[model samples]
Target: MQITIVSGKGGTGKTSLAVSLAMTLENVQLLDADVDEPNCSLFLDLDTKLVAEAKIPIPEINYDLCTLCGACSSNCEYNALMKVPDQILVFEKMCHGCGLCSKICPENAITEVPRTIGYLYEGENKEFLFNFGSLIVGEELSTPVISQLKQLISKDKPIIVIDSPPGSSCPMVETVIDSDYVILVSEPTPFGLSDMKMVVKTLRILEKKFGVVINKDGVGNEELELFCQKEEIPVLLKIPFDLEIAKNYSKGVPFLNVLPEMDSKLKKMIVDIGEALE
Candidate 1:
């Protein structure tokens, strides 16, 4: 099953839930798609092999091919190509790498060339497969790399845990695409509950079944319970606000192993989510 863990915003214990869940399932493939800050590997402690380095295709134009008749520029949806009186400029940033400009070019002047966007790593820890995709720091568009990473996943696994980047934006949506179920992780604060609503909307939009797991459950007031009660969304499992667990997390340790109840909860949570998906 492809179970993606996402949050409405960052700092909501998305990775913590993901890593803990990964440890519980044997022969699971764990994907850390938070390209900006990939902390999931901090806990996995696996040996990695370079899988693939992601790149986007940008159209390079040959000027001497004669006419700048504006056909290429006009066909570009992203406006990456603009035709001046005698010249055409390629704006790489705006390019979506669709190759439409190259396809529509009458003069055969346009050719697609790869430009680096990110890197994908594949590794293993015992029976579990660990893979992650990382985008370049200045990359404004991460959906391309994220999509590429999603395609590289091993579909034969009994279980898969994808650590998606926070929020309901393009990157997060792409990460959760084709998922069997989504585990929405959040805290119990107002910000957490508010953000949870946004992701819940995203789930409904995608028509994906999901459950919310309240991280740092006992730290905040009981408004989350009220919200869940009203919405009828199941509370999967609550990871409490414990200092030792925080310190262990801060120092790079798996909480589920230390707190045995969490492992059992996560296992049961997975079973419960599977039933919901079914």
Candidate 2:
């Protein structure tokens, strides 16, 4: 089973909760799909070694062999290619590696070239199998990296925990897609409620089974709980705001490592997820 842990916005303890939950499970595979900013490896004591490099195909124009045709530019849905009078300008960052530009090039001037965008790392300890991706800085696209990370891992594990990126954007959707269940983490603030609503809407549209985990539970906003109740969504867990937990997390320690009592609660949450699937 693949359970993707995601949030509507950032700084809602999504990664922290995901790492802690993975720690509670036995012989699981933990995938940090937040390639733009993956931090799960920091909390793990295992040695992460770079296993593979994630590359995307970018268009390379052969100026000498071609005419500046507008066909390639018109075919690119992302507008990554611009046809000037003299040449075709390529925006590497905007390219989605669709190969449409090459296919539509009348002059046969466009060729697909591989560009390394990220690195995939893996670490295995007795507890669980760890995998994650680190996107190159200034890379606007993380969906490709997330896809490569998921594709590289074998789905033979009994349980797989995916730490997804924040928001209901393409990268997050890519990470959460094809999962057995999704766990949306949020806080008890107005911003949290708003973002969580958007994420909930996304999950509903995707028709995926999902639940909510309210982090920083002591905060004085009842709106989140009310919304969940009204929507009939299960509140799987409530993690109270703790200063020690914050301190440990800042130092790259899992909250469950400092507060071992939460282990049973996390295990129960997993059981609840299993029951929900049933």
Candidate 3:
């Protein structure tokens, strides 16, 4: 089963929880799908190797065969192509690599070229396998990188834990879209509740089964818990506010190392989720 751990906003302990959960599970694969800023490797000691380079096809115009007929420009939905009087200008950043411009070109001047957008890495120890994607700087498109990273998932692993990007955007959706279950980590604060509500709405639309894990449980009001109760969303686990946990996390330490007592709780939660899936 693939379990994606996500958050509505950043700095909600999403990665921390994901890493801890993966360490707690047996024979699992952990994928960090937050291509723009993958940090799950920081807490693990596995020796990782470069697995693959993530690439996306961008249009390369052949000026010799170009006619500037405006066919490619007119058909481009992303406006990546623009026809000037003298030549056709290709905006590489705006291109979605759909190949529509190349297909519609009258002179066959446009050709697709692979552009390296990110890199995928793989690491394994006795515990579990770890994979992550790192998006190249200045690359606006992350879904392609995430797509490439997910392709590395091993079919032999019984459990896969994905650390998704925060928010309800395309990157997060791409990471969790195929998961068996999603754990939405949120704080109890007002902003946390507001963002979590948006994620809840998005998950409902996608018809995904999910539950909430309230981090820093003691600080915020009970309104978040109340909202979950009203919505009939299961409250899976709560990590209380603790200074030591924050300190350990800042030092690149997994909370499970410091709070070993919570290991049993996490295992129990996974068991409960498995039963629910069955």
Candidate 4:
């Protein structure tokens, strides 16, 4: 089963829960889909060997072969191409690789060229396969790179743990789609509750199964619990507000390493999720 651990916003212990669950599960594959800023590997401490580099093949126009007919520029929905009086300019960042400009180019000047967008890495930790992705900085769109990461999931006996992007936007939607279950992590704050509500609405519309995890549980987040009860969403687990956990995380350490108790709790959570699925 592919399980995604996501949060409505950043700094809410989303990656913490994901890494803890990854360390607890036996023979599982971890895929961190927050390509824009993947911090999961920082906590793993394993020397990462390259899995694959993700790239988007964008359309490039050969200026010499172009007649400045403005056809390619007009056909480009992404506005990557612009026609000048004597030449055509192609902005690499604005291109989406749709190939429509190439197909519409009467001068046959457009062709595909590959540029490195991000990379995928895999390494072993204890027994689990730790995998994650890194998006090239300044790359605006992440869905393509995320799709490439999803393709890496093994078909045989694989329990995939996905660390999804924050918020209920396009990137988060793509990351969590078609998952067997989703684990939502949040803190005990008004902001946390509000974002969680947005995420819950999105999940309900998509008709996916998910539960809530209250991180920093003792800091007055009863509203979240009440909201969950009112909405009939499952409250899976509660993690206390521990400064030690935060400090260890800052030093690139998983809570499971310093606090072995996390392993047991995560294992129990996984077991419960498994039973619910069954």
Instruction: Name the candidate that leads on lDDT.
Output: 3
Residues 1-278, model 4: lDDT tens digits: 99998899688988888888887877888888999998888888687787898888787778789888999888788898888898788898887777888888888988888877889888886667777788888988787788888888877636889999999988889888979999999888999988988999898888889999999889965798889899888889888788888888899887777678777888888888889899
lDDT against the true structure, each candidate: 0.87, 0.91, 0.93, 0.85
Model 3 per-residue lDDT tens digits across residues 90-181? 89889889999888888888899999989999999986999999999998999999998999999999999999999999998899889999
**What's the lDDT of the predicted structure labeled candidate 4?**
0.85
TM-score of each: 0.95, 0.96, 0.98, 0.91
Query: Clashing pairs in model 4?
Result: none
Sorted by TM-score, highest first, which candidate order results? Answer: 3, 2, 1, 4
lDDT of 2 by residue, 45-100 (tens): 89999999999999999988778768888888999989889988899999989998
* Candidate with more favorable, higher lDDT: 2 or 4: 2
- Residue range with the least summed lDDT across 10 consecutive positions in model 4: 123-132
Model 1 residue runs over 4 Å out of place are: none
Query: Which residue runs does candidate 3 get wrong by more than 4 Å?
Result: none
Model 3 score (lDDT): 0.93
Q: Where does candidate 4 stray beyond 4 Å?
A: 63-65
